[model samples]
Target chain A: MTDLYGVVPEPLAFAARDWGDLAELMERSSSDLGGQGVGALAPSVQAAASAFLTAWAGYAGESAAIARGFSSALDALVADATHTDDAIDTHFGGIDARLGPAR
Target chain B: MTVTIEVPASQPTIRRPEGQPGGSDTLAETLYTAASRYEEFADEADQLLAPRGFSGQGQNAYQAAGGKAAGEHRAMATTVERVARAVTAYADTLRDLLREWQELSDRQDVLDDRRTALIADINATTDATEAQIAALRERASALAADYAELVTDHDGLHRRVRANEDLLRQVFESATSLDEALSADGGVPEFAQQAMDRPGAPGSGATPEETRAWWEDLSEAEREAVVSSYPGLVGSADGLPADARDQANRVLLDDDLATLGSKADDGLITPAEQKVLDNARAAQQAMADADSFEDPITGERPGGQLWLYDPSAFDGDGRVAVAVGDLDTADDVAVFTPGITTEMSDVPGYTDQMQNLYESTRYNGDGSSVATMFWLGYNTPEGAIDWDTMTEGRAADGGERLADAVDGLRASRPDDPAHMTAIGHSYGSTTTSYAAADHDLDVDDVALIGSPGAGPADHASDFSVGQEHVYVGRDSRDFVAVLGDEGWIGKGGLGLGTDPSSEDFDATRFESEREDRGSTRLDGDAHSSYLAHDTESLYNLGLIVDGHGDQVNTASQSYDPWYDVPQDPEWDRDPSSGVPGQSQTRDPGQP
Candidate 1:
């Protein structure tokens, strides 16, 4: 049976999983071809192609950071619905954060 | 139904785009990959945040901070996805434009071949019936119509690309605003806002010394914030360090290339905007080319610094100044201004020529760092049309700008001012002369090559450099340089002024005759060959720029018969009556 009156663990759990997936994707995409991609395009531009990379890096890093924050909060919300039908005190581990200008 | 604007078919402007940048395909792939991730971000956020989800629950759910925060998060994710889409579209547009250029260019090649064959068919029709000749003529008409339509398509694409760029700019703005709002409310700004209130920050309008002092006082974080936020202002400031300015200007320049360079290849801008684009491209290419330099004296390879970047400065002519070496502290410096029709777009070529001048100066002078700067900080008169419309007005304005530049250079390096030389070629010499005469241009020496006249300062004594330091070079065959003589263009303000190489004017004359003087004025091979390597004029110029003016081999000034008459008048010399080319060394190396 589904309870429509309050917060539940089913969706929170799903949200946490999906948010973790987003973080994983962001990190993987950034780590794999971020530098090589920007480097290949750098010489064609000639001067200061680093700024374009910086803009991309900031967006990726910041979005990943925001997603982690929400995921952690959702887990805490699941724990707060103690007496409800969906009560699961869970703590998803954080993703390793890397913050630097994309090389 | 589509409305088509009739593009003038007379121009027949179809050519392959040259210098296509490498590695765009890799970037487009990267953008596609990134866009997919962003889409995932938005899609996942939407599914979990639906009405049946935790945030969209009971009556109290609307009052919950968690629910509200979740809404904001969802909004940001969607907005970011749009940013990703916009960037991806931008990348795709670039590739598509390149394809369009190439395909149309190939079509032109085919059309050209058909036209050639049609001509042969018409010629071979001499032995055929009236029907055969009619068929050949129809073929010619078909080919002509094909070419006209192709030109129209080329013109239409430029406008369409500009429209795409305009949309991309708006998307970027929306994303930036959304990010700033979310991030600012979530946490404190990264750097203190109070630190930016001082001078030398963008729009401070402070003097170079004050700007430098203020910049030196800023913290590392504050400096970074300023550079990232207001790159154009920071990059163009004279007081900032060379490397810092270079880094900032490169970012600004790259932005210009990405946003505005697409429609520039086929000349698809308004007259006012065209100047701005030309100047930006000039600065862009100069820095791009400077990436290849490794100083012969010192192994340092520094990118060019954009000292002045005022696009649309001279009634839409634009202005830009680029420095190849460290101008702050050097043993020698030369600020070169080019002649008629020259603009920032031509400065990269001049930058290369100036590099040669630097090499010769370094070889002859005492071992020290030498810097050469290319200054196109004026609206140069453009050939006969501009000459007729407003000739002296532009040069006079250029003179004022040149004076201010030298003043700023001095102010920026008060303690260790380098030995500076002012060099002007052809009409630029008149511009330089007005700087010295009217604005009191401060320099150690002045060099005028192929000068028609020296403006108001006809006598060398009228200049700040004094007669001993003023040098002149004239190829006798360069008829344009003869415009300064009173008899050629006739009296007071009608022409430029007295020829700097005339005996009466008394400036040190240098040998500038080239092996090949073109038969006509349009063939200006000798007129513009003063800067060529291994030439006497270039070596003499190097000596003057290096402060070894006494060492240059002098040539006799042209004699004027006006002095022979007791009651002297502006004398005329026949243009055809000049000595044939003299072999000073008969191709022997000057060095």
Candidate 2:
């Protein structure tokens, strides 16, 4: 909570990566379930199944969007950290160059 | 005017998919895993975010992201969990129906037996009364009624099974329709659409790194949408992600199979189309084999990717490349090209060997990433004994394609490059050697096993990677390995090239087994055992692919005899004649 050590980014990054991977899996599973022909079911039954599945897919899609949002947010966090670090390094590098092997 | 209907003698059986039919991915377990992943992923994301773990803008952003993600993930988990439950229910019903069917079928058998017995008894009773005969007729009618009832029940159960499946199908279909709507509303990324329409931005002229970066930038849904829409192009496109290609190619393979099968069924298939169908079937089998493969060494299922698939390439012989691991991220990658008589059907067998090689490399390395590809991307010689085998034309053409594949791999992930190894077996070795020599094959190492000859390459020095990085493996008993021998005369690299494993060629020679494991060397068993599991040759290949070629157990150089006379091995021969300075050969049989 205090963020003294600033250790949130690593876990955050991991979560983002996992979320991204999970989203892909969800999408593939959703597609497969929807597209694959369930040969055992009757046409009428299949139609009924479709209506039920569409509602589920909609929910899944919403969930996927949320996961993606989390991933993107974490990506931004990482990118910011990198940018801040790069800026600091650039400033220090200039100083070091000006110092010219003195310190 | 009443209509009369008679009771049928036996019940008609209904057929359905049993116990996870082939190519059907309706396993409840899959959805269960999705749900599980969501739970885990959500927990991890929420662990920090709920407490505002970050500082400044990042913290605020994460806090905002977490609230909705956590809720959605929870909802997704629940959704998939319910879906899984529904699937389980359907499966249970299916199993129950099967048992019910069996029971009814068994009853029919029993009824037939009873009917036969009753007939026999009536025939034997010569002095039976009219009353007894009438009673027997009633009993027979009762049996018929019972059979009629069973038939009705059987039909009812069949309908019940359908009804049950329909319920589950409805759930699936509902999700499908929603997904379709989502996709319809800008699911297909405009960049992908552009790529399909005109080969620009990451594919046509862009480097593989460019392609990968562009691909990685897209959202998961967008990626799926794009792949689903243009499976044919994306499936075969070079420099893309291996898994994505695998997915697209599988879909493409199925579509091709279905389309071609339909045409042939209607008697509208042409000869060329028939060939395409056969090749597609072969590719499908390869994918299935990859799917079912259990790595013997690792006990891991490193399933295959149809990295490249063309059902009708090379004059209907077909061309295909299968990768056993993730090519986009592997630290070590080997592109193995096979030699004479290789075709689409040969892919399944080759992919297994590639996996073996992949495992061997990983075993030898420090547990880094490795992907091995079984590449049959050339028009190979049709027969070993044919006049075509004695020419460099096929190898020359194959060499260029081999170079492109290697280059594509290099370009795909230029930021962190894989230690690429190009391997050719039998005539494939010759083709690989030519690729290295002529096409400037971009790889860190080149390994040739049981090579007939290096097309146009007289020595390892001809390769751009330098003579030191070249490796050769030929079992002494492998007769085909000697076909590359440039007998006392300078002929050429392919048909007339020097033996890669010989002292004169001066490549890094490793001991591959010469044990007569095969019934005869002429059958090519000896020639084909280079990548066999747990063997020295395979071990050396692993070491080389792992970038530890110096640690390989080197074998004594075996040279072509001077006009059929047996020559001394590398130990007895004057080693100063051909040994290069950079190659540090391991002691014979040394690890």
Candidate 3:
């Protein structure tokens, strides 16, 4: 058997959670795309084509908000980690001071 | 437990947590940069994409793409703005925590040093003789004094830093709110109007310090908008900064001059309007020609600065005020109020006197900043001989305005108030005295030149200042001074009251002799010639204005038996009755 290892950071985990929902929405919208060319088309058909492009553009635009949310969540996570590490260091220093120099 | 005990050789070094992606300072910078980029992108997209929608068949496709791109860009901009705000808040919190850590570390180091010194001192004292202990005590006392001084200095620095931080925080908050408001559609006008209402509007009841702080919080563009749109409000409002007022007033003056000049060129002005236009033009010319009018004593160019200008004032006689130096920051300021026939047209003549006084005082002040202002804010009686309107009523009304102007000067330079002197000549003297006596005028000194009276005040003490601060100068040949002495002529008196230069009125009188200046004799026109160059009156006035009262050439108190006495009927009947070869008709009631 081959030995396997992986590391998934908390920020990546948060981004993955939002990426699943966005991917599903994009997949659904992609299936409804009109296959009409922009030559000698009826007004209704042109309107439908324009709407299709606008809808796809909006679905793509949602990624920016997702990225901003992920950034904020990662920032908070890193801050928490730093605080916990400091606490651990302080606790260990106290223990060492109390149980000084094993004879 | 007989276990072996060991102590650490040194204190442990406390290490801060590492691996933080961005430090507080870096994070703040990044957020600000992101915000700026988002704003630029949004602006560019709106400019390029918004107007090109659905123009033609080929353009329609492009327009559609542009519209989609612009919409996405705008949404991304909003998203980024939210992220930047969050990041900035986080950064600020981190910065505060870091500052706390730094302060703690600094305190710990100080404590460690003190502990080490105390231990050494303890060890030395344990084995020391009594004399050594006393010497150590003396050194410790000296150290205590040094520490006290250091603490005082540290407290001052800490307070300054805290104040700076507070100001920075206020500015940052204002900028953030302003940015948000400006990002909204059609928000600029609303924001500007709000700004005008709060701080830009005149008579808003904001204190000078508050107004100054609010002014500081504004951007340069915002300040320009306020000045351009609200010149009348800003130019005359008290409690606004002097430089701001001067800027606004200069703009107003230029615009007025331009408008009047255009009207005159078109020949559309009435006779009265033409006079006003001419006066404004002549004042502008005088300011331009001030380079040639050098001080006779120091030969320095005393360029006149227009402080106040109103071309359509007082039925188009035009009210104006000009200063010689920077009154805003001067150490000493003298404001001269001209009496009869003073108007915008006579500004050059009045400003000439002010410039002479300004230069003389500046030369005598020995590097002290001195400014002299020619104040023609009042509508003086039209004719030189108009005594009816020159009485106390006109002075009373003008007194209020004078008081307000003085108060405005004080308010403008509240941080560094100047030593102000109110000098009034002729009927202007009555106006100044009325302000001092009744209106509670704020001034360091009150000086009257060729004065008829001290308004309603019988003595110098009535002006709410020290008697020594009241200065009076009068040429004996000046006939106006006698008007106040004739009590039987008018209701109460012919003029305001008893002459301030009289011995009984108890004012410090300065010498003002009517003499010739080389070929020119200023004897008959002694009242107007009080400000003549190389005259004792002008020199004394300059000294008094510079707050050098001890250096003034004081006039000796010569007793006049007829002082304050009613004019005898015999003397009034014929001018030659008192002395031969002096034949002239007497007008006892004439001003």
- TM-score of chain B for predicted candidate 1: 0.61
Give the residue spans of candidate 3 off by over 4 A. A1-103, B1-192, B203-219, B289-303, B384-390, B486-492, B517-523, B558-591
| TM-scores of chain A in all candidate models | 0.61, 0.66, 0.44
lDDT of 1 by residue, B162-221 (tens): 544444444344345445424422111234234457755545788777877777797654
| TM agreement with the true structure for every prediction | 0.55, 0.55, 0.52
Question: B63-143 in candidate 2: lDDT tens per residue?
Answer: 777765665565555555445544554554455567787788788888778777667766666666777777777767777
True contacts kept of 2: 0.27
Docking class of 3: incorrect
TM-score of chain A of 2: 0.66
> Any idea what lDDT model 2 has?
0.67
lDDT of 3 by residue, B1-591 (tens): 222212112222423322121432333333233333333334433443423111345335434654554555455444323322322332333343445445545654664575457547755555566676666666555555544544554454344334323322332232233233234321122344466767535657765455666676765545544554455666666666665665566555544454445344433345875777687776676565543555444556544556677767888877777787777777899989888767788888777788768755754555677778888888888865566455567788788889878887887777799989999999899999888989888999988987877777888899856688998886666677655653323325556687777666778877776443222222368778777655667767777788886667677432235445443211112111111112111122322
lDDT of 2 at B279: 88
Q: lDDT of model 2 at residue A85?
A: 67
For candidate 2, give the docking quality class from DockQ: incorrect
lDDT of residue B164 for candidate 3: 27
